[model samples]
Target: MYRIQEDHLDINQLTQALTESSSECGAIVTFVGRVRGSSEKNRSVKEIYLESYLSMTNKAMMEITEEVQLRWSAVEKISIVHRIGVIGLCEPIVFVGVSSKHRKDSFEAASFIMDQLKISVPLWKKENIEEQGWVWVSAKPSDKQAALRWRL
Candidate 1:
């Protein structure tokens, strides 16, 4: 599921959603994204404001979720939630979870979703810093490279 909210996410709810009922899975990979205090130059940040096209954002995420299912045979569950609007420092921004019969597939798929979300998702963040003023930010080349690896 996708959302654009100001309230904090419930981790227990996410964990419950990710837990699979089937006994075939041995590993459940999870990646949690939090608002970082560092910027492009590793400067300290006070906060970040995230914006996005709500309708399109959910559609894109669902596409990635479907791709995760198609790319790995053992994947049993996938859950991703991204928050938008004014985000506080060190707060959770996104959550990615995947379950698989083996560790390798679950890890890889979980990593792939995180990378793709960073690059492909149409989310924008404006950094609020103490020394400097607010500045809008976009996906970096390193993030693009991370997403590229999955396509290859």
Candidate 2:
């Protein structure tokens, strides 16, 4: 399952749903990405505004989910939820969850999904900085590196 919305994420609900009917899986790994109070450059952040091409974003997320399932055949269930619109600092922005019979597959799959989502998903972020005001956030080199490592 995958979704792109402006609503705040419900961490508890999402996690429960991931384990529902997933009794066979021994591990359930989940990740929640939150809006940070400070930016990479040490700027104070008041909020972040996320924009996305809805249909394209959903399609890309679905494709990433399918790829994860193929790469980790032991993965039984996957869920991705990304929020758009304006989000306050420390609020949850994205959620990724994966269930598998082994902890290794579940952890790796969850990490891969987040990395792919950062690079492949069509979502843009603008940060409201204390001094600089609103500025568009760019992809960090470290993020690209993280995703590249999975290719090997």
Candidate 3:
């Protein structure tokens, strides 16, 4: 499942999503993303404005989850969440969780989900700064490269 909210994410909800799965599981791997004070562009950070195309973002996340399942036999479940609207520095931006029978599968799936989401997810953000002003931060090329490694 997926959602966009201005409020803080619920770790309980993320855990619950990964726990509810079709394939029986033993281990669960999870990741939480947070906003940073600095930008890749090396500018002073203030707040971030997040946005996305609803249907496309949801579709992309679901597709990535399915791909994780198809590639890893040990995987049992996956959950992802991304926040939208204004977010301050150091605030959690998103979360990805994966469940599996073994650590390897859960670990790989969790990492893969985050990497894939970076590029595929339709969400966008703007970096706010004191002097530099607000600049839109799109998905990075490195993120695209990371996602390409998992493409079908």
Q: Per-candidate TM vs. native?
A: 0.92, 0.97, 0.88
RMSD of 3: 2.1
Native RMSD of candidate 2 (Å): 0.9
The number of clashing residue pairs in model 3 is 0
- Per-candidate Cα lDDT values, in order, are 0.83, 0.93, 0.82
Q: TM-score: which is higher, 2 or 3?
A: 2
Q: Candidate 2 lDDT (Cα, whole model)? A: 0.93
lDDT tens string, model 2, 1-152? Answer: 99998888999999998887466799999999999999999999999999999999989998998899899988999999999999999999999999898999999999999888989999999999997899999989888899999999
TM-score leader: 2
Look at candidate 1 and tell me the lDDT of residue 43.
Answer: 83
Indicate the residue-level lDDT of 101 in model 2: 89
Query: Which residue pairs collide in model 3, if any?
Result: none
Clashing pairs in 2: none
- Rank list by TM-score: 2, 1, 3
Candidate 1 residue lDDT tens string, 26-70: 888888889898887888899898888988887788888889888
